[model samples]
Structures are given as structure tokens and as C-alpha cells.
Target: MNTIGHTIKAARERRNLTKEELAQKLRVGTHTVEKYESGEQIPSNQTILKLSTVLDIPTSELLKKQNI
Candidate 1:
């Protein structure tokens, strides 16, 4: 899984939101939410923050972890 998948999963769990509910809030298709969770696609920075806000996660946590 990709960074987005991990982040999405964690955030969703934190907010107790299902994929369908997240999709509704994002106003995107459920498939889109699935894709993000499955690492099939990565959203832009703006969308990432929007997702973090909606999911109540920090942007850093939602972003890929940097290698030391």
C-alpha cells in the first residue's frame, strides 16, 4: 500500500467514517475513495489537506513519511 492508503485508513478509523461517508463528504465517487485507500491514485496537496481536515488528521501524518 502507498502513503495515501495508509493515511486514509488511519484517518478514517480515527474519525469512525466509512468509505461511503468519506466519499459523500468529499463529494467524490466512492471508487475514488477506494482508489485512494488502495493506493491507485494520489491526490494533490490541496486535496490532501482537505482530506486531512475532513478526516481530522494532521497534514504531516497524511503525507508520506520522509526518510531520515
Candidate 2:
């Protein structure tokens, strides 16, 4: 299964959003977003909720295991 980082990266790309743009929306640093996409860091529950809203995807979808 694809990791959460890959899922987040794919979702962000599908929405045509840059890491900086998403970071702005999430009120976090660009590096933090980069870490998230790289699987070097995992977002907190609150951040996950924010990501779902920002990405316009369901939280369950974001949390779901993806076939790699």
C-alpha cells in the first residue's frame, strides 16, 4: 500500500496545488509539507482534518490504504 505521504502528495498534485500553497492554507511551513510528502513526518489529527478540507477530499479517503 502507498503510504500516507504518497497519498497526500498525489492528492495535492491532482488538485494542482504546490507545497507552498498548501502550506499557506494549512498555516504550516513549506518544509513541514515537504516532510509530509516524503513520509518523514506524519501530520497530527487536526492537521489531517485540515488537509482533507484543503484537498476537498473526505477524511476517510485520505486515511484509506492505497494499492501501490
Best by TM-score: 2
Query: Cα lDDT for residue 68, model 2?
Result: 22
lDDT of each: 0.80, 0.90
In model 1, what is the error at residue 8, expressed in angstroms? 0.7
Q: Give the least accurate 10-residue stretch of model 2, judged by summed lDDT.
A: 59-68
Where model 2 places Cα greater than 4 Å from the true spot, the runs are 66-68
Per-residue lDDT over 16-37 for candidate 2, one digit per residue giving the tens place of the 0 to 100 score: 9999999999999999999998
* Candidate 2: residue 41 lDDT (0-100): 88
Clashes of each: 0, 0
State the TM-score for model 1: 0.83
Cα miss at 55, model 1 (Å)? 0.9
C-alpha lDDT (0 to 100) for residue 65 of candidate 2:
82
Off by over 4 Å in 1: 66-68
